[model samples]
Target: MAVKGHGMEVKDHGMEVKGHGMEVKGHDMEVKGHGLEEKGHGLEEKGHGMAVKGHGMAVKGHGMEVKGHGMEVKGHGMEVKGHDMEVKGHGLEAKGHGMAVNGHDMEVKGHGMEVKGNGMAVKGHDMEVKGHGMEVNGHGMEVKGHDMEVKGHDMVVKGHGMAIQCHGMEVKGHGMEIKGHGMKVKGHDMEVKGHDMKVKGHGMKVKGHDMELKGQWYGGKRSWYGGTMSWYGGKRSRYGGIVFLNW
Candidate 1:
């Protein structure tokens, strides 16, 4: 004998098995009771409480609440939140455990964010903290026609583990600025400045219209004021090139 009731409450009388396929196989049963509250021993099963065997599809509410374990199989796109979230097989995979927020803009305002892989790449704007910043494994930050400022200890810009090479302008240390083509400096308390600067094998070279050094000038040839020619601190005749004097 089969008895079914809609919008009914059967309480305290003892054993209650709600749904079809209880005593008989190949039969469909559905219990749609709205706002039904079961307090003690809410749901239990001897084997597999909710099992969908042989190509069956089970979908819960739009905002379903599962208190315990949740599993998905052979699905294209599956999303899970809270605690253990696992995925098997590779090919365009995004898996996160211990609070993973996946969106267009994911903002994490907590502690510790880790990315474990051989090489991690970032295609957008990557900004670091004020005091500490780093790049590893033959990869450094590359900015095209933009300014980068690092205000901390030991600023190193190296190519093949050697300072700087092939640059328009390269500055180092405190108060020393460089601004032209082909320059190099490797000494304590050194200053090198140029226009259209390049720091290479040689040294400092100012390849521009005007070049000045410590109130002295060099355009065509080397000469001092009052018709005096000094080469390597040796005086000679300085009546050929133009010399400017400050009175």
Candidate 2:
């Protein structure tokens, strides 16, 4: 069936067009202009109760549902079930999930979940993340009531008996703390006050010596004069950097 614009084209058992080239083919239907296209076994749009089968379903605005096989959605009460699922904003809900997402009231249930923003709630295994006031329970606990930002590098903090209170955070590696808020590390070693952190490999010492040390061989003993040491490589050890002395 072939129908073109500006009204009136008709064929029984399929092919009905009225204004702006709307086309319908017996079992394989197509409608143009305002953009509505339908094929056999499932397709519905605009009124928002969208349906599609054997995968590939799309819905825009309010209460969306897609069953089985890779589902993708955009805005307003988004829902996805089983197999490579992707979702976008507003009261987001995912079941037996897969993920690639954008923000707003997030909720995810089981199976390789990926992340985005806003009032987060995640339950059950495999979580990958983005931002916004977090609360994660059931074996992969990330409970941040105010703020959380994780920039990756195999960062792991697992909890069952939780106690994490930070005014600020940035961990480069090993044994972390920022009481009175201040820490920055580039090697090992830690201690801070006021706020500043920078380190570049081995032999670290701080006693009110407002920091700044660069690579290779620093055999400690500089109290408050812009620190220095030389010969860059491994083994001549003792870095343990980041002990802020009011800078």
Best model per lDDT: 2
lDDT of 2 by residue, 1-247 (tens): 1112211122221122232122223322232232222345434432212222221222222111222222222221223333222223212232222122222112222211111111111111211122211222221212233222232211222221111124433333332333333433333433344444333353222223223333322334332122432112122212223443211
Candidate 1 residue lDDT tens string, 68-110: 1221212222223232222222111122322112321112211
Best-fitting candidate, scored by TM-score: 2
CA shift of 175, model 2, Å = 3.1
| Residue pairs in candidate 2 whose N, alpha carbon or C atoms collide under 3 angstroms | 5-21, 7-19, 188-240, 188-241, 189-240, 191-243, 202-239, 203-238, 203-239, 216-230
RMSD of each: 33.0, 22.8
